[model samples]
Each structure stands twice: as structure tokens, then as C-alpha cells.
Target: MLIETLKNRLVLACLILIGLYAVVSIGGTLFFQYEPNSQDLLQANTGPGAVHWLGTDYLGRDLLARIVYGIRISLTIAFFATLINITVGFLVGSVSGLLGGLADRLLIGMVDIFWCIPPFLIVVMLTVVLEPGIKNIFIALGLVLWIPTARMIRGEVRVIRNSPFIKFARLNGAGSFQIMARHILPNCIPVLLTTAAFSIPDAIMAEAFLSIVGLGVQAPNASLGVLISDGLQSFRVYPWQWFFPVLTLTMLVLCFNILGDALHEAYSSKAKGLLEHD
Candidate 1:
């Protein structure tokens, strides 16, 4: 079944990478327990050797330790923000699609209005207004990211509502909530899940960009973005400072993208099968 494939390959890979990140994040607290911001200029700029696996930065903090913690924080932000995006998107889309007329028109128009605004600009402006921290980053990213997701879900919902299944559900005297929950929403799950996978990397990169601009995760809290920002200042002298964080971030993003693509294909195939069955 499609579920088996998702588990065997795409979902499994994502889970494994997520698990590795968790281990690095949680294990560090028990072992190194190195304060990510505690500076030790004496041990600064050391390359990977017997002691440090990824080496120390200009501040002499363990790069590996900081990155581990940073990944934890970065992933946390992405996961939660994306969750909020999907929730809002799904709700708005479902309502717009299931309830046609002026309400649907107004909702769809609002989503389009949101889509017209540049997401990055909105995030930057919000970051400027809000106090900097992990939570603020989450809010900024979620607020902007939901627009695209809502658009996609709305499109999908519009298509599904016209299908025979929806008509059948309505003919059975099903309530709006019952029809959506029992028929429309279940059909939309694969699309929603795939879209969610794609959103994670976007959220991650957005967080990094926000941090680089000095509005994201504040000092003392480790984030891949903040780490890269710090690394850039000394990039010429300590190329390793930039190299490792960038490499790790690249791999994480790449993995998520690949997983998203794979899920999308699989979902499309499943969607096709469901149609055939109907």
C-alpha cells in the first residue's frame, strides 16, 4: 500500500534524520553541556582534531555542540510554525471550498490578497516590530507561510468539492462539518501532508535569514542561522566556522526537499488510485 511505501522510504528517512538530530540535541545536554555562548578566546579557532569533532569557533565554543543544539531549536521552530500554517490553511480552505457563495468569495479573495504581499518582506517587517526570540520567529514565519498553504489547499478543496463524492455526501443530508470531515478532508490529507513536508525547509531557511538580519533567535541561543551569521564575520580567517554550519544546513534542507518530492509523487499516485476506485 501507499502507506507502506511512505514508511519504508520517505517517512522512514525523515524520521531517521529527525531522530539523529534529536540525539545530537538531547545527548549534548547530558555530555558536553557546553554553554553555546560562553566565550573562551584561548581555545578559539581550533580545527577538528582529537577533541572537537567540528572544531571551535572564534569564541571557542564547541561547534558540534552548538550545531546540535541549534538544529534542535531550528527544527522545533520549523515544525511548530509549519503546523500552524497547515492548520490555518486547512481550516480556511475547507470552509471556502465547502461553503460556496459570498463567504467563499470573500475568503478566497482575502487569501489572494495575502498572497500578493511578499512573504519575506512581511516576515522582516514583523520581526522588526516584534521582540526577537524563538517564539517571535515562530509567529513571524507562521503568519507569512500560511498564505501559500492556504492558497494551495483552497485550490485543492475547490476541485474536490465538485467531485461526485462530495455531491454524494451532501445528498445524504450530511452536515457541513460531517461532509468535510468524512469526505473532503480525508481526500485532501495526502496533498496536505506533502505540502507540509515542503513547508519545513522554507520555515527553516526563513528562520536563518531572520537571524542573519539580527531579528531571529537572539544571542546565547544556538540556531543554524545565527551560527552561520557569526561564522560569516570571520569567514575569511576561519572558513571552517562557516563551512560546517552551512554544510549541515544544506544537507538538512536538501533531505527535506527530497522527501517532499518523494511524498508528492506518492500522494499523486494514491490520489489517482482513489479516483479510479471511485
Candidate 2:
């Protein structure tokens, strides 16, 4: 019955989107063959044709191949970066909420400082100092993006910490680590999933924006943002170059957002039901 509620249209759609992304990122990158960086001057700026399913870009590289590679690259970076960001957030937020003292104040103050400043400005400065590269961009993005996740975890932890089950565990002589690992952490799972899932789209969007402005992945690497930027130059002549990449980015972002939203809603409903039962 509970599972049925979660298997609604939105959840199914989310699954489809995730499956598509996985297929494109894994299968396309591994099985599908074509060098995204290899250029052919003779084939440059050509419209879609039999040979090039999507078309050839300004450098005469295969647009389809670049798009596939771009999908893989963007998704790969976003996934890992989000993981890093979430780990940072989880540690800081959990410690703050669980300990709750001078430490909490200090950690929350740090979060405030980062939250007050525009993350994009920080990212831009980091790129200037760090230079445009895959790993650096990953660090820059993951650094600036953790504040929100921290806040979410802190809020959820504080609420879950006060639950009677937590008190019972404390009464049962469970250590702080045991209580957190078994009691608080399990209860906070929904918030963690929702927060982390939502962060994926934001990370992807930031990477795209930075790449478009030339502060992202450098040349010879295929990024959706870079491809979109390149296509903008010749869009009037060859629209497919720009159109396909933009379409892909939009759909990817939309799917991530919807998936996160659906997860959030489902979890909220389940939590409410449990509370009512209690």
C-alpha cells in the first residue's frame, strides 16, 4: 500500500528520466564510439546527414558524439560533485545538530557566511584562480553548493533529534555515535535523499553556466555548455548545433528537478502518515 502511493506518475517519470540518463552516460560513453575532440575541417559546420546523425560542428567534429560525451561528462561531474557536497553538508549539519553548543554556533556561522555571499561570484573567482579544468570546477562547485544541503540536514536533524524514539535510545544507554547512526540518521534519510537529489540539478546548471562563460571545462573536452556556446556563434546558419544541446540540458535539468520534487512529496507523505500513526 505504501509502495503503491510512491509508484504514481511522477515517480515513474522520474525513473524513466534517470534510466535514460544512465543509459546515455554509461552505455553511450562506453559502447558508442567516436572521438568528441577529433576534428575534420572538410566536414565542419555541415547540417545533419546520414553520416553525422546530428551534424558536424564548427571544427567538423561529430556533434552526436560530442553530445553523448558531453552528457556523460556533465552527469559524471555533477554526480561526484554532489556526493562531495552532500558529504560535507551531512558532516557539518549532523555534528551541529547532534552536538549543539559552541560548535553548532561556529558551524552554522560558517554556513551563514557562505550563504550570504553569491555562490556564483565565488565560483567565478575560483575559476580565475584555479583555471578552467574538470577537477577544479568540480571542487569549486562542490565547495559553494554545500551550504543549502547543510541547512537542510541541520533542520531535519534537529527535528528528528527530539523524537521520543531518540529519547528512548538515549535511555537505553546508546552512545552518541550509535544513536546517530541507528536512530537519528535513519529518521533523517528522507531529508538527506531529497536534499542530495535536488543538489544534482543545481550543480549541473552551475557547470553549464560556467562552461558557457568560458570559466568551465577547457577546449578539446566536450561539455554541454561549451557545445551550446559554440553553437551560438553559427546558430543562424546551422541551428541544430545549438538547438540539440540546449534541448538536452533543459530536459536533463527538468527531469532531475521533477525527480527530486517527487521524492520530496513521497517522503513527506510517508512521514506524515507515520506521525499520525504514532
Candidate 3:
């Protein structure tokens, strides 16, 4: 399965792009001379050249540096937010599914309530209510973005909980925790990976939207959305400011989406094959 997934050209290409972005975002400081926040008034609004590869923003800050750093910030936030999202969703869903009865009903009911509300609206409200910063953004995203994951996980766990292997494990004296840890979770890996892949881009876009509206990652610290917002002022005159950031953001999101689709396809095919064999 792993070999076949790697053989997929679209999946391979998206992986490479995502890897390049991750590498640049993580180790960019080593390669770039300019700091994202560094300013040079004289060089402000300059076009792409030897000194500034991508160009300069209105404040004469290096656009390339800012974009790389922005990518880093966005990825970092998304990574952590997704971690929180997965952890919370896993706990809620697994518990609800395993316990069943009233607990399942209550938990699913709560999740359904959240599911009905738009995630973006929930995130926006949370960000507005809480302080505006990376931590708050993480919290807001973590809290709102787990609904789908929870619902999916709940269904998956419910099905798995009744499987022959699970019944065997229970007969062998395996506790709920042991069964969940050793058996159930391993079975759910495909779902978790696919959900996580999709969730990351959702988080990235959400953060960008929040930043665009001046509710996320304040000035001096550049996020793609922050750069785009600033660039809109000079968009007519110097388009590079927004163009590069927008392009990078688009590619980043696209790569994740494609990767998610690839993973879903791979897993679905594998499942179908197993079912046919059975």
C-alpha cells in the first residue's frame, strides 16, 4: 500500500512541494540574509532584483523573507492546531463510541450541534472573544475544527468495536484502553491521516482569513494573509507584494488538498480490496 501510494505521480509531486515548503519554512533563516521584519525605507516598494528576489513590501522589508517566515508561522499554527484538534476529537469520539448508550447519544448530540454551525464562524467568534495571538488562534481553531473528525471517528470506532478481532481481544482480557490503544487506533490510521491532511489546509486558510481581517498574527510578524492585506494598498502599483504571498498560499493549500485526496483514494482502494477478499 505504501509503495503504491508513493508510485502515484500526483501524490509524489504534492509531497515534494509540501516537503520543499516545510524545509524552507523551517530552515529559512540559515539561507536568507534578511529578517522578515527588517526594514529599509530607501528600498521600499522596489521590484524584484538581485537584492530582493521576490521584491520589497511597502516598508522595504524583504518579501521573500517575509513570505518564508509567513509560511513557517502558518504551518506551525496549523500543525499545533491540528494536533489539538485530533487529540480532542479522538478522545471524544473514542469514548463516546466505546461507552455507547447515553454517553454516545450525548456526545454525538453535542458534536452535531457544533457540526451545524459553520466552523469559520465559530473560529471567528472565538478569536473575537479571546485575545488575538498565535496561541489564541490555535485554541480557536482547535476548538472548532474537530467536529468532522469527531463524527467520523465516532462512526469508525463504533464499527470497529464490534469487529471479531475486538471481541477476541476482549475475551482475552484486554481492557478498553488496551484494545483502543493496540487495536482500534491502528485500524483508524487511514481515517486519521486523511482527516489530518484535510484539517491542516483548513487551519492554514482559517489563519490567513483571520489575519486578512486584522484579527490574527499582528504586524511586524508576517503571515501570508497579513502580507496580502498590506499588499492590497499598493496592489495597483506594486503587485508583487500580494502576488507572491497569494501564489505561495495557493500552492500550499493545493498541495495539502491533493495529498489528502491521494491518501483517501489509496485507503479507500485498500479497504475495497480487503472487503472483496473477505
Which candidate ranks first by lDDT, i.e. highest?
A: 3
On the 0 to 100 scale, the lDDT of residue 265 in model 2 is 81
What would the per-residue lDDT of candidate 3 be over residues 1-278, giving only the tens digit for each residue? 55778898888999999999999999987989999889899999999999999999888999999999999989988999999988888888888898799999999999999998998889989999997888899899999878888888898898779989989999999998898789878888888888889999999999999998889888677778788888888899999988999999999999999888888889889989988998
| lDDT tens digits, residue span 1-278, model 1 | 34655666656786688678777776766767566666779889998877777889988988988898899899989988898888888888888877889989999899989788999998888888887889888888888888877777777888878878778877889888898788877877877777778889999999999889888998789899999999999999888889999998998888788778877878778778988997
| lDDT by residue for model 2 (209-244), tens | 998888988888877888998999889999999999
Count clashes in each candidate, considering only residues at least 3 apart in sequence or on different chains: 0, 0, 0
Model 2 residue pairs with clashes: none
Candidate 2 or 3, higher lDDT? 3
What's the lDDT for residue 187 in model 3? Answer: 83
Q: Considering lDDT, which of the candidate structures 1 and 3 is the better prediction for this target?
A: 3
TM-score: model 3 vs. ground truth: 0.97
Candidates ranked by TM-score, best first?
3, 2, 1
In order of appearance, the predictions have TM-scores of: 0.90, 0.92, 0.97
